[model samples]
Target: MLLEVKNLNTYYGESHVLQDMALSVDEGELVALLGRNGMGKSTALKSIMGLVKPKSGTVRFKDKDIAGYPPYKVARAGIGYVPEERRIFPNLPVLDNLAIGIKGGKIDAGNPDAWTVDRVFKHFPALKARSGQKGSHLSGGEQQMLAIGRSLMGNPELIMVDEPTEGLAPFLVMEVRDMLKDINKVGVSILFVEHNLKVAMSLAHRLYLMGKACLAFTGTVEELDAQPEIRAKYLEV
Candidate 1:
């Protein structure tokens, strides 16, 4: 497994947010974490990336235990995270924003590639066209694209994305989804937390439903698609 999270528990002050959450991802796979709002899906991603310190559990990446490491250490260990809010440097130019996120390392060019600025530009041409523009000047979709592109510059083996498709037009959502598919095609494993079932089903090979701060069910996308009752019980508003 490229990423393995086991029996993870996290808290925010007095509230327990993630309870015994566990999941795994292999190389080149796109896995979805699904649930309604306030189910700890984003917390799980934060815990893995070391933004939220877990009370207990193991987070193993590439066979190294990184349970309580800092966020910078996690990034250095080859994990890239795109938070739910598209957090880009608003004052910085597009190219500078991407350049700041770059971490120097050996990139695999032959297969399962690592991203360069050129490759990132190819994936998001709008960013290329607006390389000189400030991040605050871009559209919502463009900011989202820049967010993903910034993460890619780190050359991570795994990317954990939270709510990549939220608050976008249908056309922009489709474009971002396709961009994620293209990135996954090159063998980078993805752990995505998403509320959009249609997008999750279309993109993920495996599905994990979260509820009450724990994983309720996990299986292939086909299995999840067949369980309408599960959807209505846990996912429907």
Candidate 2:
């Protein structure tokens, strides 16, 4: 497995947000973490990224145990995170936003098909036009593209994205979906936290549905489609 998270337990102050969560992504795979609001989807991503420290768990990446490591350490471990909030620097230009994501100028040999600013521009041509524009000037879709592009600049073996297509037009959502497909084609494994079932159904090679602080279902997209009850019980609002 490229990334394996086993028996993950996390909390927010006193609330038990994640309970023994476990999932895995093989190299070059695009796996979707599906769930409704407030059901530990983002929390699971944070726990893996070391943004929210887990009380106990084993996060193994490329045969190495990385649990409890700091955020920088986790990033250095070939994991890049794109938060749901799209936390780009407002005053910085689009190029600068992408520039900061380069890990010590480049990634190691883990990601053979690495990303550079020019490569990012190819994936997101809109960004090239806005390269000199400040972050605050871009539209929501443009900002989202920038966010994904920035994370790609790190050249991580696995990239975890939170709510990537949330709050966007249908056309823009489809655009992002194609963008993700292109990224996955280059051998970067993906663990995506998505609320949009239709979107996830279209892209993911495998699906993991989370509910009530635990994994509710794990299967392929066809398997998920075959189980309407599972969708009604855990996925449908």
lDDT of each: 0.90, 0.92
Off by over 4 Å in 1: 104-113
The weakest ten consecutive residues by lDDT in model 1 span 105-114
| Candidate 2 segments exceeding 4 Å error | 105-112
lDDT of 2 by residue, 25-77 (tens): 99999999998788999999899888999999999999999989999999999
Write candidate 1's Cα lDDT for 111-221 as tens digits.
456577788999998789999999999988898889999998888889999999999999999999999999899767899988889999999999999979898889998
Model 1 lDDT at residue 153: 85
Which candidate should be chosen as best, given lDDT against the real structure? 2
The pairs that clash in candidate 2 are none
Mind sharing the TM-score for model 2?
A: 0.96
Which candidate's TM-score is highest? 2
